[model samples]
Target: MKIKSLHHICIQTECYKESKEFYTEILGFKVIKETPNFHKREYNTWLKLGEIMIELQTAKISTNLNKWSSLNEGPVHISFLVEDIHEAYEEIKSKGYNNFKLKNEKEIYKVENGYLFKVKAPEGTEIEVRDQQEI
Candidate 1:
């Protein structure tokens, strides 16, 4: 068996509207397709950012994100590559997003390869925006 590349990341949200806004408006993801009543659920939206797509689905039952704790069984967080970390951070702040946790209390934290910042999505998902560079 062989693995090619990551196609998409599926996110189940209790409220689709809020989640859609966060991914679209805040993160600058474009809505590629939206299917109403998809798979016996309220709706399913496909959001694209560069070459990646995020499958945003509506959960039939209330979704518990586990508060994004490290003890969770699934993914701990989602990270995105951007051209400019400072621009992304400023844009997010301008959009009235203050729920992000900065590393070491710095506006833009330096990682092993590049700079980045972490923000909490509406569904309590931690999203990392990193500067575009080799990693």
Candidate 2:
């Protein structure tokens, strides 16, 4: 068997409203489908970002941390690749998401590929935005 492509990523969020708004309003993902009572859960929202899809559902447990520790678990972070790093940074800044300190004091970090920055979602999930230099 061979895997073709990733269909979506599921995120369990404690606060459905905030998470929905964050992914839709802030991150510019389009809503494909929304179920108010999915499998007895509070909500299940399917969002699309370009070719990728994100499934946001009500979480059974609450993690009251400010942000999820990258070292603590299964999936570390979800990253989005952009064309312009500066433009993405400015856009995020203009939207008032200034709490982007991860690893270092600076917001954006330059890597071998390009540049990236991390932000915490409503459930403390790490959302990374980055740019890739053409090979």
Candidate 3:
């Protein structure tokens, strides 16, 4: 099978405005587009960080979404691209981030010319970081 880099990620947030601000402000991303999906009674927003784009979905229902936030977890997590994952880890750790402890680490999958790791973001959302390349 042929595949490309991660195209996009969808995050479900109860507070659309707050989540949008946090991503734009804290993550150094810019809002590119936003639309309302009446069928789901949700709001969809597109954000960009360099060449990568993230989709933030504000839904009225569970949408299943990320289990972390649904379970009252804090700080939704999204896997990030980095040149050196170890360095990235250190950098995040320096920011006083708590290491994400999960039940999996069984195998590191390699794709898009990079290794991968499943981590919980600061907000408790599960993020899968792959393609450790210089951004």
Candidate 4:
């Protein structure tokens, strides 16, 4: 068997309202689905970053408390496969997101010609975003 690539990244947020704003408004991701947990009123947000899914689950839903409410731990790094990382940086910054920092200026990731950027979102979820291009 062979392993290919990542499918999605999961994130836990203490405040869904904050993450929703940052992910949808600032970061530019579309919410594809929002469903209640059936047993509980708490829910999850299924966001898409160019076909990639970022699962944002709240503390009320996440069973793994260690990973859910830990402020010390940041959201899981979601690497986007891009054709031009430089262009991505410009695009994101142009949208008024000025806090992104380029981690590797000379090198990129294996998938989608990705470039690493370390940034943060609302509620202090440190994001290691790998800028990627369209397929």
Local distance difference test scores for all models: 0.85, 0.81, 0.63, 0.64
- Tens-digit lDDT track of model 4 for 61-133: 5453443233455444444444556676677677677666444453323445544665567555555555545
**Any idea what lDDT model 1 has?**
0.85
Indicate the worst ten consecutive residues by lDDT in candidate 1.
Answer: 61-70
lDDT of 2 by residue, 41-110 (tens): 7778899988999999885433332445778758889988888888988987788766675667788898
**Angstrom error at residue 12, model 4:** 1.3
Please report how far candidate 2 places residue 105 from its true position, in Å.
0.9
Indicate the residue-level lDDT of 33 in model 4: 94
Q: Between candidates 1 and 2, name the one with more favorable TM-score.
A: 2
**Better structure of 3 and 4 per TM-score:** 4
List clashing residue pairs in candidate 3: 74-123, 75-122, 75-123, 75-124, 76-123, 77-121
- Clash totals for all models, in order? 0, 0, 6, 7
Q: Tell me each candidate's RMSD, in Å, in order.
A: 2.1, 2.8, 7.2, 5.9
**TM-score, per-candidate, Cα-based:** 0.86, 0.87, 0.52, 0.59
Ranking by TM-score: 2, 1, 4, 3
- Over 53-123, each residue of candidate 3 has an lDDT whose tens digit, in order, gives 98887665556544454456554455676666566545444555444444355434555677665645433
Of candidates 3 and 1, the better by lDDT:
1
Candidate 3 local distance difference test against the native: 0.63
Task: Please report how far candidate 3 places residue 125 from its true position, in Å.
Answer: 2.5
Q: Cα miss at 20, model 2 (Å)?
A: 0.7
